[model samples]
Structure formats: C-alpha cells, structure tokens
Target: MISLLKASPAGDAVSALLDCHDRIRSFTALALRLARAHDLAEPEARDAAAAVHRYFSAALPLHARDEEESILPRLRGREPALDAALAVMVREHREHEAAVGRLLAACAAVSARPAELARVAPELEAAALDLERHFDEHLAAEERVLFPALRALLRPEDHQAVLAELRARRT
Candidate 1:
C-alpha cells in the first residue's frame, strides 16, 4: 500500500508532479474500494472518506495550478506536437475538475455519516470510476509525452521558475 501521506521530493518539479500522479491514483483507488466496501466499519469508512476528500479537495487544485500557471505556459509554441498535447492536457484538467467535484461530494457525504456509505455507494462508485478512467489516460499522456517534452524544451531557468512557483503555492 502506498503511503498516502508520503511527501514528494522537493526541488524537482517534474518528479514532484509524477509523485502527485501516484497519489492521485492511490486515492482514487481508495475511493473505489471504500464505495464497494459495504461491510466496512464506520470508523474505517469515515477515515478513508476523509483521506480521499482531503487529497482531491486540497492537493489536486494546487497540482493543476502548477501545470497551468508554471509548466504548460513555458512549454507552449515550442513544438506543434507539444502545443497540441498541452491543449489536450488543459482540456483533461477541466474534465478532471468536474469529475473530482462529483467524487468529493460523495466523499463528503460518507465523511459526514460513515453509516451512510451504503446509501452513497452508487454515487461514489460512479464518480470514482469516471475519474479513474479519465485520469488513467491523462496521467499517461503527461508522463509519456508532456513531461518528456517539458524536459527537452524548457530552459534550466524555466525549471527553476517552476520549482519556485510550486514551492510558493505549497507555502
């Protein structure tokens, strides 16, 4: 089991983003598991729901901003192919935000009343599945295409700027 609370390395913005992706996947999976676990005890259910909620509600938006504000803008117009990939990344970010809202709502419901998991399970499952599907593809694209392109195209100064922005946002 990946420790959801593990900190990503500092200084390397790209590696931090990759670590964030891993956390995203882990939390999404936890949401799915909690949704399906009809017999889970209330305390365990509540803890799991809260964990998922905290990650999506707080960390995710910051990660998106790191890409949109610091990383993507720097990479734009460097290559036509990269430009197209960046567009797709933006579109997918919007989609993920919408899906995350739905998932968070379900998580909030469960967190408020862990005993209500049975009632909220359907919505939670649907939202988690939607996000999982979208994110699986989205993370792949960034890891395979965008990150490599970012490494190739961005200047050392650009990376420093990104690192600063990433750190500043967290602080």
Candidate 2:
C-alpha cells in the first residue's frame, strides 16, 4: 500500500518519524496478509512471520521512544491546547505497545512452527486489524497536530537536538 503521507527529505527528525510510520503501516499490512493466507507454504509463512516479528519487536519501540522521549517532551507546554493532545498521544503509545506484544507473540509462534499459523490465524488477524485501526488514528493525530506544532514551535537548534537524539537511539 502507498504511504498516507509523502516522504520528506532525509536528515529531518520529523521525516524520519514519517518514514517509520510508513514502515509500521507496511508491516501491519503484511501481518494481516500472512494471517489471511491460509494456503501459504511453510517457507513463506516462516519468512513473513520473521519479518513481522523483527520489525515490531525491535523497530517499533524505538519509534515510540523517539516520539515519547525526544519529541513530546519538547512540545509539552508550548501550547496549553496541545497538552491534552500530547497526553492522548502518550496513552495511545502505551496501548500500541501492549497490542504489539500480543501480535509479536503470535508472530513468534508462526515463526517457530509454520503449521501453527492456522491455529494462530484468528489472533494474528485480530491483532493486526486492531493495530491498523489504532495507528490510523494515532498517526493521523501526529501528522495533523503534533508534527505541524513541532515545525512551528521548535527552533532550528531544537530540531537538530531532536534529530541527534533520534540518530543516537539507533546507534
């Protein structure tokens, strides 16, 4: 599926975050596809499960931290109106984290034994759909409200600091 938003230039923290969002959407789609693919071969099942597992297990938490630790903290108090939105963002992150844990467990089961895919298909589908629904709202909120705020309220120096923090977390 095409990304909801256009790609931004490299080296911008917000752009990096947007890229991560695209990835989250892509893997979520893959999870849903894998769950529904009843006739998939063993090798394909294992590969798909591993790909989904790796992205959610590792990359997702880092993206969340990028928002929660690096971005949200700076945006706080800049606008009294944004405080409520920021709180919602944090709450949703927690919710997504919990949901991802369940999804990852399902992915792990399929990865360990491809035959297990049939047993776990319902769970995997439910979790993937749940995540898709939640991310649709959460990512929209950030793109609509938070990202514009980040660009408007923060100084160039602040953007550099945030970018540095994001890069440091990866390394």
Candidate 3:
C-alpha cells in the first residue's frame, strides 16, 4: 500500500493524504498505549514518548499545512458548500495541535516523575481519544465530500500545484 502511494502520480495526491491519515492512526495508537502505561520510566515508555513527541511536533504539523495551505484553498475555491465544513476542519487542526502541545507537556512531567504516571495518563489518553474522534469525522468529510469535489472540480494545473506544494513540505 505504501509503495503504491509513493508511486501515485500528481493527480492522485489524495492517495498520499490518505496514506498520511493511516500513519496518523498508527502513531496515535502508539502514543495512547504509552500514555496508558503504568510505568513512565521504563525504557520502552520513554522511547515511545520520544517517538510520539517527534511525530506530533514535526510530521503532524506538516500534514496540517498540506491541507491548510494546499488542499483546502483549492477545494474552497470550487465548492461553496464546503465553506462551513472547511472552517470547522481548519479550527480542528488548531485544536489538534493545541491538544498535542498539552500531551507533550504531560509526557515531559511524567518522564521526570515516573511514579506520577497515574496522574498524567488520563490527560494523555483523553487527548489521543479526542484526536481519534476528530480524525474520524474530518477524514470522512474529506474522503466522502471534499476529495471527490476537488477531484471533479480541480483543473490539471491545480492538481499539479497541490502536488508540488505537498512535495515541497516534505523536502
């Protein structure tokens, strides 16, 4: 599946986005598991926290930018009805980032006080759960409504531009 996504052409950038969503799901699960762990000081726990921290701090923001800067505007230009949903999705992105920020802080605190794992676990778990719910709605909206609309409405050049922007961010 990943190989196919990498082979996707410019017009199939939606495939790439979907692949990103899959990665987000996997990473979120890992983060959730780490959050629920009873021992924060375990070597495995710290490793998981570091991995989640790196992913949320770096790759997640880039994924959001791909939507905000590249995909959403193009979709908005063509689909008026999408205005409301897009606005909500945009706000949700910020909420996701903010929640990640809080989770990161909590992870830091738990790392320093391994015995306080019980204290911070709920907050981290809640953040992960919220993110999962948000993704369920947001991804459905994009897959069912936004992506199809964009595919139908966007010009070839528009797709080319989106692909370039998405590629640029990773580089």
- Most TM-score-accurate candidate: 2
lDDT for 168 in candidate 3 is 74
Give all TM-scores, in the order shown.
Answer: 0.91, 0.91, 0.81
- Selected candidate, larger TM-score, 2 vs 3: 2
- Give per-residue CA lDDT, model 2, range 10-87, as digits (tens): 445677688888899999999999999978999999999999999998888888888989988998887787888899
lDDT of 1 by residue, 1-171 (tens): 223223335345577778879888999999999999969999999999999999899888888888898888888888898889989989989877777988899999999999999999999999999999999999999999988877777676776777777777877
- Distance from true location, Cα of 119 in model 1, Å: 0.5
Clashing pairs in 2: none
Q: Report the number of backbone clashes for model 2.
A: 0
How do the residues 1-171 of candidate 3 rate in per-residue lDDT, one tens digit apiece? 124234455446676787777778888888688777764466666667767777777788888888888878777755567877778878888777767787777667655665566777888898888877777887787778767776787777777677777777776
Give the top-scoring candidate (lDDT).
Answer: 2
- Which 10 successive residues of model 2 have the least lDDT summed? 1-10
Tell me how candidate 1 scores on lDDT.
0.85
Taking every candidate in turn, the Cα RMSD to the unseen true structure, in Å, is 3.1, 3.7, 3.3
Each prediction's total of clashing residue pairs, residues at least 3 apart in sequence or on different chains, is 0, 0, 0
